[model samples]
Target: DGRCLKDIHCLELAEFRWTLKQAFGSSQPSARYGHTAAVWPPESEIPGRDKDSEFLFVFGGHSAVSELNDFFAFHIESSTWVKVDTGRQTSGPSKRFAHKWDWSGLKT
Candidate 1:
C-alpha cells in the first residue's frame, strides 16, 4: 500500500507470505505502469523457475506525457534487470495502455 522503490516482491505460497525479492545488479528497468508482463512468452517458450529463461518481461507502457515503447526483462534467477533491445529503430507496436497480455498461442 505504499511505494515499491523498484523492489520486486515474490509471493511465498508455501508460507503464505510476501517476500521482497533480493535484487542485484543495476541495469533494472525504470518504474513504469500500463505496460505488459508475462511469465511465459507468447508461446510456452521456457517455463518459469527454469535454468535458461527465468525472466519477467515488461514491455510498452504509458508515461505522464505519452505512450512508451520500451522493453525490459527481469531475470528472477539472477535478480537483475536488462533492457531488451527489440532491434526496432521505429515503432514496434501500436501505443497502448491499461491492457493485459496473455498467451493464447497467438499474438497478445
Candidate 2:
C-alpha cells in the first residue's frame, strides 16, 4: 500500500502503532525476525513536558532494514509506547525521507 523511504524518517501515528504490534508479534513472527526488520530504525529524541519543565530524551531500537515508515513514541511516566494518530486530514510533514523532528514544547 506504500513505498519505503531510503535513508528517510517517517513520523506517522498509524505507523507508530503498527510498529508496536509488529514488535510484539507472535512467537513465530518474532523467531523469524522478518517483521522487525521492516520497521523504523533506532533514533534519539528529546520530549518536552511543558514550556518550563525539563526535557526527556528517549532512544529507539534499531530495525533490521534501513527503510522505515513506522513511528513509535514512548511515555516516560508510563514507560510504554504511546502511538500517536495523525488523522487523514492532518498535514505537517512528509512521512518519508531523512527528515528530522524537534520538540518545541508547545501544545496545539
Candidate 3:
C-alpha cells in the first residue's frame, strides 16, 4: 500500500530502545516508503535567528503507481511538516531509494 506513518517515534537511548509515541502536526508527508532520511542536529549552522532547531528531511520514494522525487521537512521545535518545492522534477535528482545525504566541510 501507499500508506505512510506520520507518527514520530519516541526513544530511550540510554536503554538502547524506543517506544512508539503518538504525535500530530498540521500536515504530513504523503503516504510513502523507501525514502531516505537525514537530520541536522539542533543548534547547528542555519540561516536566520532560529534556536533549538532539529530537522528531519525525507526524500525520494515510490508509491503503487509512480516514483516520487518530493521532499518533506519536519521541524522539531514547532512539531510540523513542511513540503519543500524543489522546482521542476526534470532538473532534480531522479527518483531513487537507499540514498545518503550529508554535509561536507564548513563553507561559508
Candidate 4:
C-alpha cells in the first residue's frame, strides 16, 4: 500500500530494544513521511509529570496528497498527542518535507 501511517514505535536504549507503541492518544498526526521530529525541551522536566517524561515535537511532513506544516507534540509518559498552533501573529515556515529541525537554538 502507498498509504501513510500514524503508528508509533519506541526504542529503549537501556535494553537495546525496539517496541511498537499502541493505544495512543486519539488526536495524532496524519500518516506522513519526511517529517521532522525531536525530543523537545531537552533534558528538562515537564510540569506535573515525572522527571523522565518528555515530549516529542513533530513538524512538517508529506501526506499522500501534499506537504504539511502542521505541528504536534506527543507526551511520552501519557501516550498523548496534541496539535500545536503556530499563531497568526508570527509567520512560520511554509509547508515542506524532508527538512531538518535544529535544536541547538530551537531553530527550524
- Give the per-residue lDDT digits (tens) of candidate 1, residues 22-45: 766666765556778876443255
Please give the ranking of all candidate structures by TM-score, highest first, separated by commas: 4, 1, 3, 2
Tens-place lDDT per residue, model 3, 20-108, is 64444655676666778866652355545453566778887766556678888887666678887878767888887656667654461
Best by TM-score, which number? 4
lDDT of 2 by residue, 6-98 (tens): 121224566563222222212111111112222122232234324232212222222344433344443323333434444632453433433
Off by over 4 Å in 1: 1-5, 41-52, 105-108
CA shift of 5, model 3, Å:
3.7
- Mark the regions of model 4 whose C-alpha exceeds 4 Å error after superposition: 1-3, 44-53, 105-108
Model 4 weakest 10-residue run by lDDT: 43-52
lDDT against true structure, model 4: 0.81
- How high is the CA lDDT of each candidate model? 0.68, 0.30, 0.68, 0.81
Candidate 3 TM-score over all chains jointly: 0.66
Evaluation by lDDT, superior candidate among 1 and 4: 4
Show the lowest summed lDDT stretch of 10 residues, model 3: 42-51
Q: lDDT of model 4 at residue 91?
A: 86
Would you estimate the TM-scores of all the predictions?
Answer: 0.70, 0.32, 0.66, 0.80
